[model samples]
Target: MRAIELKNVSKIYKNGVKALAGVSLTVKQGEFIAVMGQSGSGKSTLLQIAGLLDDCTSGQIIINGNGVSRLNKNVLADIRMKSLGFVFQSFHLDTHLKAYENIMVPMLINAEYKNKSAMKERAIQLAETVGLTNRIEHYPGELSGGEQQRVAIARALANNPDFILADEPTGNLDSKNEIIIFEELKRLSISGKGVLVVSHNDAVKDYADRVLTMKDGILEHTDEK
Candidate 1:
């Protein structure tokens, strides 16, 4: 099954910046795809489109078999909350919530599980998946950057979304932590979740099953490992 399909997608910002120009791509289920580009190369824009955080100026985005281009804002938000997982360069966990609570936020809002107990159990499972079982009670400020990102990753996975859209997820980490995070991402893909990440680090090329290089608002056909 295809996790995402973008056909001739284009995005032009209000300030008249053309971030993406007629880009087309397909991500199959369980594939690990990486988009490599410098700043302003449209990698982040592509991710936003795939995650339903932003709409394209033209063309279609089919995510998990649903056409997302024409969905109303409310429906789009629902799709975003339920169908996609996002990891960002900065750990966007709530400062006030403990790691477990942060991971549970999405589940609570989406009512992902039938009961409160089930939700809590799933949150704990995700925290353990991200290697944060012991740190689940720690607040974001109390955790290191890597730990915070792990919490964010667990939060993203709380919904068991079929697709993961990550934007420079390891950008804020040290080399050691970057490796750890990338390994977790790899595991996610290996476990049958499609993963698409926007990255500028050459190290990502080593981890990606396919690498797309973007330049001047267009994606270049690139080599893959």
Candidate 2:
């Protein structure tokens, strides 16, 4: 089944800037896809639209068979909380919370997880998977950039989302840390969570099942090596 679908999607900012121009694409379940482009190519816009954080000016987005374009604000929020996970270039972990608490925030926000202890256990399991087992109790301030990013990834997976939208996920890391994050994302793809990433780094090419290039807000399929 297709995890994501876009039909003639376009985005025009309030300032008369066109971010996306008639973009169309489909991502299958568990596929690892990379969107590559230089700055200002609308990759970020596409990522936000795919993740339901933003809307398109014209067109339809069907995610997991649900039409996303017409959802009310509250419904969209619910869908975002349940179906989608996002990782930013800058690890957006809560500064005051420990890694475990940071990962639990999403569950708490959903308000349906009455079993606090179970959620805690889930958080611990995610931390372990992201290789942050020992740093579970550490606050964001205490960890290095890579460790913080791992925490962010763990938090993104807390809800067991169907897919993840990552924007420049490896851009903030050093070479060694970049490799670590790459491996973790690849592992997640193998385990069947579709990953859509926006990156300019050539290092991501080899890891992608398909690579798409964007120019002037238009996307083209690239021949993958």
Candidate 3:
């Protein structure tokens, strides 16, 4: 089964703003897909809908062969915890928490890890994966922007979710850091994890297997490389 599938999805706000217009997509394992668009083009809305952070007005959303468009809050939370990971433009790390603690948040809440030491070990591995082994105990305030964003990415990987959704993940970084951030995302894709990234920078598309453009909440054009 595809990691995630959106079938004719549409989103209409309560104020009558149609953010998505019959958008459909299928993301398979190990595919690095980049979505590019200008501001107000519904890219974030699309990610919100795809990530189940917001509801869709109409359509089917299947993840791992199970439909989740209308699942209850508890069920949705369960699925989110088990099947999805997200990286946002603003690194959402808790300022008071250490990098290792931030990365351990997801696994701590996951029902699969009964032993706390295992969770901590996994968090350390994630920190190592993101090149933060030397700074695992640093707080977000002590870290650079790139380091903070790396922490967010590490937290996103804690669950080992089938897919990772990144919306403007490198928006705060310089050119060098932008490439660093995207290289980590590319590595995840190379390691058999499905990745969907929404970016405004053209350079980001270079790391993707497929590039798609969104306009007025609709996918207008696609290029596969």
Candidate closer to the true structure by lDDT (higher is better), 2 or 3: 3
Positional deviation of 154 in candidate 3, in angstroms? Answer: 0.8
By summed lDDT, the worst window of 10 consecutive residues in model 1 runs over 216-225
| TM-score versus the correct structure, for each prediction | 0.96, 0.97, 0.97
lDDT against true structure, model 1: 0.88
Q: How many residue pairs clash (N, CA or C atoms closer than 3 angstroms) in each of the candidate models, in the order given?
A: 0, 0, 0
Name the regions of candidate 3 deviating beyond 4 angstroms. none
Instruction: State each model's CA lDDT, in order.
Output: 0.88, 0.89, 0.90
* Alpha-carbon deviation at 140 in model 1, angstroms: 0.7
Q: Mind giving the per-residue lDDT tens digits that candidate 3 earns over 1-225?
A: 858899999999999999899999888889999999899888998898888899999988898898996689999988888778999989999999999999999988888888998898999999999999999999999999999999999999999888899999999989998999999999998998899999998888789998999889899655844
The per-prediction CA RMSD against the true structure, in angstroms, equals 1.2, 1.0, 1.1
lDDT of predicted model 3:
0.90
> Runs in model 2 with CA error above 4 Å?
none
Sort the candidates on lDDT, descending order. Answer: 3, 2, 1
- In model 1, which residue pairs have backbone atoms overlapping below 3 Å? none
Q: Whose lDDT is higher: candidate 1's or candidate 3's?
A: 3
